[model samples]
Target: MLTSTGKLLSMGGKPRNKSLSLPFLMNISNTASKQMTKLRTLQIGNVDVIGSRFNGQELHSALCAEGFDSHHLVWRKMGSDAKTTEIDYPFKTPMNNALKKLESDLSIQSILHPAPFAIALNEHFRAADLVHYHLLHTGWFSLLGLPLLTKNKPSIMTLHDPWSMTGHCSYPRSCDRWMTGCGDCPDLEVIQLMKKDNTHGMWKAKRDVFAKANLEIVVASKWMLEKVQTSPIFSHFKHHLIPFGIDLEKFRPGDSEVARKKLGIYPGNTVICLRATVSPFKGLPYIYEALEKLSTTKPLTILTLEDKQLFKDYLGKHQLIDLGWLEDSNLIAEAYRAADIFLMPSTAEAFGVMAIEAMASGKPTIVFEGTSLPEVTFAPKGAIAVPMGDSDALTESLRRLIENKELRNSIGKEARQLAEAHYNWKTHVSRIIELYEQVMSEKATKANR
Candidate 1:
């Protein structure tokens, strides 16, 4: 229950629900939520392109559906969303672009990017009753302007990755330097790489910015929330764990026979679908090793999205059907529907939206442990998880699903049930709306006091 001051109260004065369950989010009263319909919301993030950007776009549309005067501001415009406005990055000349590249190469990323300050001057930001930010560190918004952007607003930031807390790199692979001041980085070649080791200085700069910033943090998984709790830069802020949701209706279980016919795949072949990415964090080496170990009498058809030719060498013995960067969500959902099993063995994921999408499509998914995939997918029940980089275990799990039809059916059914109960798009929007209202109410109480 929510108190008059908008603070969440426990049932009968007990502790409140803290888990990423739907029931906790449902605690917000309908009257409070209805009041938020007239609220103006401004969401800022990297433009809607692929990955996490799509999540922001979905939320923007959902808020509009809920009658909020919602607007989106992005660093660039990759999609044709009418409500979204692109930030004005000055000096788009050739020399300026070269200088920007040089700055990024030196690891001074987003410092020269004017998107953060530009957002403060944006009309949408000025009129917004509540402000939400996502994916700000993707070579766009600088942390230096975060304090100014959020100073007098009821602001919330959805931490899509560990990038906000860390000095450099989105994922601190095997490096504990981020916990400390982050000096002397072991690997400068990590994503958002810094050619020079100014990690300590960068870390200190972020810490200073965070000290002056008034923002509530949201994480999609317990693993990510744990990361936030441990970070000296962000440990003081209020935190919420809300799992990412998917379109249950669009990605629901479908007939494999019909889907295969639509995709032109052999109806009798056992199909395994996966998003093919070249990133080392995705654990593609383990996937290749696991596929090599699988000894099947019949050739297994490999279905891939994004890059197609990455698996061209394995095409002779095993069939490869590459969907090649699908822009249409319906087609992507169909790719999931056509497959009997889905593989997303990411080694260092914050959260796996694809795993849940596969689960919603009623396909048994295989993932590796030590990341948020297991928890997000409800491991050993909705999805199968093996030790990280254990190709043997991955191969064994794949073989079990391929050989046993009953096991696949059982797991797929369970995955679908969990996806329906927990990952509904409407439920996700409702949770976010409740948070917006709570933040506004708290701000009001503070002003009254």
Candidate 2:
């Protein structure tokens, strides 16, 4: 039981006061009844992960599978030539384009078809309901749509990264300037020609809007929740810690020999794999350093589906087998099975989804302590966590696993069990439903009074 002020209320105990509190007891009974009733919810997001080849897409699918009326509102950027919708160029589409499209769709739908947020909020405000928003501080969405959706609606915002909490739109671990309100930004010239003064103003505006939103802030990791709680941006909002989930059925253990054969690897050599989208934050440089230190005797293969040129440039004289982009889940699962250990040396992670995916595949994961990596991979029997940025520790941990097959098998089995218990999608979705019920019942009781 919980009080109206968000504190836990005691049950199964004698009343401390002389008053029996019939009204309070009656309220609790009525709240329980309201919780059992099914609810219709609206989920607002700028990206759709189901059809896209990204983690956010996978998260969207998982939430939809959990019985929410989840609809993804994507941004499509308008072009200079509005008439020319088709493009012949082979250049990768910019993210700004996507955000623009989402805004346009939201505007159009609210007037005619009515976007999910507008329709759901207008219809369900008096009923048991919730509005879940993903990535609320991505500039375009926050500036245009967030104010409209959150003005009178009971809203929850999930922080996918620390961009919203900080003044810098991009993270600051790589650059020192972002730590102190993001003036003289390194990426400013790349994005647009903005004066340092203008950038500071923009960041302040964003921060102010976020502070006044009155949102229930949901963080994917405890590390993130702690950071948000300390930060000035979200210190006032209610915080909830809910980690993302993985599909265990799609990422389970399989025959190593068969998996290796399918990937055309030799029958004898041990495999060490790293799966990431060739980004600097993923710490490809550290992996290269560790591999170079272990190259002489380990005879290990490093497999990734990232850029071949970038990997080759970072790892000179070291061999890296490029698998290219893998869209199929089964093939990815087989690749995980073929590997002896999964390596991730990320400098900063909101939550290490790849690490959990590897563990679900019954493979022991090697991650660094600090950040969200330790939080995700702290299962003692399942993972080996080394100090962050220490190549020596990484090399030693990898060498131990390479030498001992029994230790590897033991850790791998434990990792799979941990994944089944905590990282499963079903478990996460159930918790979310419970939270929704609890919050909605509280709202309903307050309204009746």
Candidate 3:
């Protein structure tokens, strides 16, 4: 585990220099007096990772706490977190809005925005020893400037979805056209929908940028890594398979009685918790269909987190509890604790953070096959997985978990164990930090050569 300079390396992949007390440091020079500088990282994405979407906020805070100078540059700043900075474009809002409309019409993603230039000019970007990109297909970043923006700097992009390799879609569902050049897309109505069939052009643009850029790819699931390997655009880059992590202490098993009481739920009901937002890729229609097939003696209570409330009119006699969008981690954890079952039947999920959170919270979660969920939850072992889009199978899976208390307990226990062993928050952050060191070390070696 020793680095190139023969510095003593620790199990966590950080160099332990006798002269320097700090564990994480960038050796800027190999002269007589090796200047040990603190590593500064700049993370760019559409929104703050600390928000509802993912668990990136944990990494950002962990980086800062570990004495690494970390800054998050998001397009929309949600909270007063000092580590996050909002991107300030030079153009007026109206002009940018117009450009967005034009870009969408022409099916050119991230080409019209000057946000990349803005990011390059930012003080944090200039001072950053490494830059990490996340969720960049949100239409604000400029793909054309990716090579120039990352020039002479070690860069990493976490493939939050399959959008980076494909033409227009994020998941591609069952489509394998991304393996080729991505011409003549079968469905343009997918997420990040295109106005025209300029998918080939957009795919080519990304390929060109990635060809010139020194970028490493990271995926949270093995399923996603397979797609990356098949991608004509991203297959050449180095890939990191790092699963997402959650705070096990906050999301650990709790008394369901207490959780239900706090959430205002009476006894004698089977509670199922799921994400509220309705998307084409989330397989909401199948969820609705499965609910219709289940015939349970106990009353059903559907608890939803996030914005949309889809169960109000759908569940006839069943109860519906929508907590709306939750920003606080405590409340979100409480919602999971109250649930007897957690369902995520996504047709195209890269890596489901909620699935692992529910697993850590000791819930028997169910997911569909043909997506990352099966691999993420360890399939039929850590979670109950049914065939993709098969409502009848989903209903049978639900019935098996509901009618049998011992089965639910066993599955939940195993799920929690899996989450702890594989998805520890500290381990996840340390692995990433190691990646940063690896990338920096390789670059330094190349420069010396």
Candidate 4:
């Protein structure tokens, strides 16, 4: 039960069947949650995952639906659909905030300075039964604040990238400096930092700082889970593996003919899909080269969510359907339905959620065989796993899908079935709640002793 001051109280002193009309967030520090017989969770993230369309937001909304007091404390808002009870990190000034963003790749600055976001957490941190922290390094929230904020609390940190493991880089591709100790940084220039490499000290600081806190870990993919096991710091803690989930209803199969008509795509036109930032890891160049080799006898269009200017150089007279950035689920589903095949030829991914989203929309996906893609794609059924970074292989996969309508439709049907069977929101959230219950139960037992 929530008191007038937004604190959690044991409901044994209160009545059952009462509607919780209190605001979603309540700061219940100093209230002692052990007295309560029921479980209440506190999920923390850098964005209102419920309002946003990211995979993390999907999990946030699912948690809210399960009756947990879930809230996303964000540093910034991208869209204007404001959610209730979000605690924004207090920035000192507009210019200072912009300059600080440049150091996002390194946690060295965070170790030196303190963020006001930690102040908010201190005031409200102890209010929940267990706290779950998600992807934080987005120009705000400091990793330096973690040990202090989560000290002695039953908290869980979900590893989204290797940034926490390494001194600087998020995805340390082909780098094993993080294994022994992060020093003699190889990706210094790529980090785009203004200063020299202090990766060794930065990594050492995280080891020492995090050692003080009682924290659990969660990884979204088997690849990431492997990293956790090998890492010197993360290997010491308990962890869980929870893959992402998508909304089946919102991303369900739509009328392909109607969708194509709506998008102004004429009959006999083959639509190919690509999504990702203009990064090397996402295989943008592979997508570019593969499309260049595609047979052009039939009218072909590249359906992309990124703006035209971003891919202006790559668009060599090829038909382009640019939707810019889409936040609405229905519009994304429309794009998926209008397309003949979805291609995410990336070498790296942490449980590719967008690939599943395309599959859930009944579109046959094509991906490179590496990282979390193979596990997530359900290849030969939902998607075809091609050799990573081979444009010829990608072209062959795309050609096979475009040439045979029956094969494409068959793959799409299996893709939807795969999504329905394994990637539904309910099953994913239930597993999360199970973890929550186990953590809280241990806490209760500890308190009794």
Best by lDDT: 1
lDDT of each: 0.81, 0.61, 0.80, 0.68
| TM-scores for all predictions | 0.92, 0.74, 0.90, 0.83
Candidate 4 yields a Cα-based lDDT of 0.68
Any idea what lDDT model 3 has?
0.80
Distance from true position, residue 276, model 3, in Å?
2.4
lDDT of 1 by residue, 1-449 (tens): 23222354422234455443445454434554477778999888877666542447778877887678898887777888899887775663453467578777766766666666678888889999898988877665567788888889889999888977788888995688899989888888878788899888788888888999999988888788888889999988888766778888899988888988888887588898998989878888888898989987755789999886988879788889989998788998999999999999998899888899999999899998999999989989999999988999999999999888899999999999999877877666767776787688899999999
* Candidate with more favorable, higher TM-score: 1 or 3: 1
- lDDT of each residue in 309-335, candidate 3, tens digit only: 578885568878889888888898999
Q: Best by TM-score, which number?
A: 1
Off by over 4 Å in 1: 1-30, 49-55, 89-99
Candidate 4 local lDDT, residue 310: 53
Q: Considering lDDT, which of the candidate structures 2 and 3 is the better prediction for this target?
A: 3
User: What TM-score would you give candidate 3 relative to the actual structure?
Assistant: 0.90
The candidate 3 region of ten consecutive residues with least summed lDDT is 27-36
Better of 1 and 2 by TM-score: 1
What TM-score, to 2 decimals, does candidate 4 have?
Answer: 0.83
Ranking by TM-score: 1, 3, 4, 2
Query: Model 4: per-residue lDDT, tens digit, 35-78?
Result: 23244455566566333534245555555555556544444444
Indicate whether candidate 1 or candidate 4 has the larger lDDT. 1
State the lDDT of candidate 2 residue by residue for 311-339, as single tens digits: 66534444457786776667778889999
